[model samples]
Target chain A: MTVQATLKAPGEKLIRIRLELEAHEVREAAISGDFFIHPEESVSILEEALLGRPGTQEKLLKRLQDTVELGGLELVGISAESIASCALKAYENRKGPGKA
Target chain B: MEEWRLIIDRPGRGTYNMAVDLSILNSLARQACPPTLRLYSWYPPAITIGYFQRLEEEVRINKCRAAGVDVIRRVTGGGAVFHDRELTYSVFIPLSHSLALPSIRESYGLLCSPIVECLKSYGLNAHFSPVNDVLTGGAKLSGSAQTRRNGVLLQHGTLLVGADTELMFSLLNVSKEKSVAAAEGSPEGRVTSLSALLGELVLDGEFQTDLSMRLANAFAEGLGCVFVQAELSEAERREALEIEEGLFKREEWNRDRSIRPAFGAAGD
Candidate 1:
C-alpha cells in the first residue's frame, strides 16, 4: 500500500492511501491526529468500515467522508475537494502513468 | 409478560454469519425493529480477528490456506477468536432502548451475567473479567466484543462448548516470538470447556438449551423488555448479501494493506 497526505490546515489533513487490492475490501488502516470526536466509540466504527476495504480514489474518499460524517465528525478545514484531489494525485503517482 | 424468541439458523459460512450480524446492526441503527438476540453457528470453522488488529500479526495466512480455514476480520474490536463448534450469540439494541445499558463495561456485564450464572449452576465458578471476557479460574471460556454507532449497539461473543486449542494455537500464528511475547504479556490461563466443567451434570444439547433460556431470562430482567422470536427481515438479508458481496468476501478487504515489519524475511 502507498499513502500520501496533504495538510489543509491545523487539525485537518487529507490522506490518500493506494491499496494493491484486487477486490473491494479494506484490509487495514491507520489514523493519527490530535482531536476528539464525540462518543469516543466512533473511532471503532470508523476502523471497522475502513479496514479491509478495496476502493478506488473516489469511492474510498466518499466512504471515508461518509463514515466520519455518520460518526458525527465535523468536516472543518478538510474539505471533500481536497481529499479527492489528494487521492487522485496519489493514485497517479502509484500508477506512474505520467512523469518518467 | 416476557416473550422469548428462539432462532436456530442453518449452519452457514463464516462471512455469511458476519454479514448477518452487520445487517442486523445496520437495521437497528435505522430503528427498524426491537432489540434482538440471535443464536447461530458456522459450517466450516473460521478465524476472525478484531477490527483493528493487524492481519499479518494475528493470522497465519499460509497455514490457514493449507488447512482450509477461512480467515476474516470482524466489525467489532478485541483479540482474535477461533470459531469452531462454538455457539455464537449476538445482541443488537437501539441505544435509546431502556434496556440498552450505558457504558461498555456495564453492557458486557449485563449481557454476560447469565452465562456466568449458568456456569455457576453447573458447578463452575465463572465471572466476567474486565474489558469483556468471561473467565473461570483465570481461563477464558468466552470472549466478546462490541461496536456502537448510529444509536445501535452490537455485541457478539463465542461460547467455547468445544474447540481444538492446539490447532487454534498453530493456525493463529502464535508461534512467532512477538506473538509469544504478547501472549505472555496477557493474563495467563488455559481455555476451559463446558463439558469439562459439567462432568456429566448436563447433556450437550440440554446444556445449550438451558444456557439459552438462562440468557433470555437475564436479558428480560436486565432490560425490562420482551424478546420476540424473529427472522431476518428481507431488507436485512438484502443488505447482508450486498455487504458480503461488496466487502466481506472480497480479497482486498480481507487481506493486504498490512504494514509489514521492516525487518525479517520478505514474506514475514
Candidate 2:
C-alpha cells in the first residue's frame, strides 16, 4: 500500500510526502509543499533527486544536502532536514503490512 | 552621511515597474550606480507571484485578464501579492553595505524597521513582525521580499493604502482553510489599509504624494542617507525597457516557468 504523510512545520509551511519503500530503496516519491525557494524550479529538481534513493536518515540527509548544493536551491521557509525527516516519518508510519 | 538616489516614479505598468527595480539592482551590482530607493505604483493594478510560486496556482488568470489586471512574476521569493491599492518601494544596495546583514532574516528586520517607523510617523503603532513584514494594530501593513545576486541585494515591498478586498481575493487562489476563514470573515480581512483605518478613501493623488514624502524622510533618517531626487538615467532606462519588453513581458519568464504555491491554515 502507498503511504502518505503530511507535516506542517514552523506553523506556516506544510510538506506532504507519498512514496513506496521496497527492499530498502525509496521509490516513486512525490513531495509537494507550500514553500518559497529561490530559483523556484529547483523544487522539481529536488523531487526528482529523491527517486530510488535510500530512505534511511543518513542517505536521505545526504541526498537532500547534495540536491541543494548541486542546484544552489535556497529554501525560504522549508528545510531539507524537514523534508528528510518527513520521508522517514512517513516510511515508519506506512500503513502497509511489513515485508515477510 | 551616505548618499542615496531617490525616485518618486509616476505610476507604471507592472512589467516596467519590475524591470526598473531589476535594472537598478543590476547597476548597483556592477557598481555603476549608488544605492537607491524608488517609490512607485502600478498602472492597471497587478498581481505578482513570488519567484518560487506557480502562476496558475497563485492567480485567477481569466479573472485577472478580464479585469485588465496584469499578472507578473517577481525575482524575489514571497507569497503572491495583489499590487493594487498599495504603495510600493524597492531599495537596492551592495551586500557589503552595513545595513545589508549577512543573514537574510536579520537584514529583513533591520531594513523593515524604517518602514515600521514610516507607519508610526503617521501615528499608527507599527512594528516589524520578523522575516520581512511590518504590522500595525496587530495586522500586517506591509510585506517585503528580497533577492540577492552578484553581491547586491534588492528588497521590494508593498504597503497597503487601500484595497478592494473582494476583488483582491477573487484574483487569488486562496487555500481551503483561508477560504473557510474568509467565509466566516475574509482571511485577508486581517489586512487593513490606511484608508480603511481612517474610515474614508483618501484622494489617490494626495495620498500617494504624501505617503511618498513621509517614507522618504523616514528612510533617510533611519538609513543615515541624504536623499537626492533623481530620475532614471539613460543606461538604467534602456536596461529597464529591455527587461520590460524581453523578460517581464514574456511567458517563458512570467508564466510557463512558475511553481505552485502551497496553502496554509489561514496564515502565511
All candidates: CA RMSD (Å): 12.0, 6.9
Q: In order, what lDDT does every prediction score? A: 0.62, 0.76
* Interface CA RMSD, all predictions: 10.2, 3.2
Query: Per-residue lDDT for B102 in model 1?
Result: 70
lDDT score, candidate 2, position A2: 65
Candidate 1 C-alpha lDDT tens digits along B1-268: 5354445566678888888887777776666655778878788988887654456766888988898888886766566778886778888777887556776667778888766775676677888876567888767788787767667777898878776788888887542433443366543235777666665644555666666666666666655667776788888788778777766776766664232111111112
Model 2 scores what on Cα lDDT? 0.76
In angstroms, give how far residue B267 of model 2 lies from its true place.
41
**For candidate 2 chain B, which ten residues in a row score worst on lDDT?**
B259-268
Off by over 4 Å in 1: A1-100, B1-6, B175-189, B199-207, B256-268
lDDT of 2 by residue, B1-268 (tens): 8899998998898999998988887777767788999999988798888775557767899999999998998877777888887889999888898888877877788788888888887788888876667877766778899877667788999999888889998898775544454356522225778887655436655877888998999899988999999998898898888778877888887875542322111122
lDDT of 2 at B127: 80
- Model 1: residue B37 alpha-carbon error in angstroms: 0.6
Measured with C-alpha atoms, the lDDT of residue A84 in candidate 1 is 49
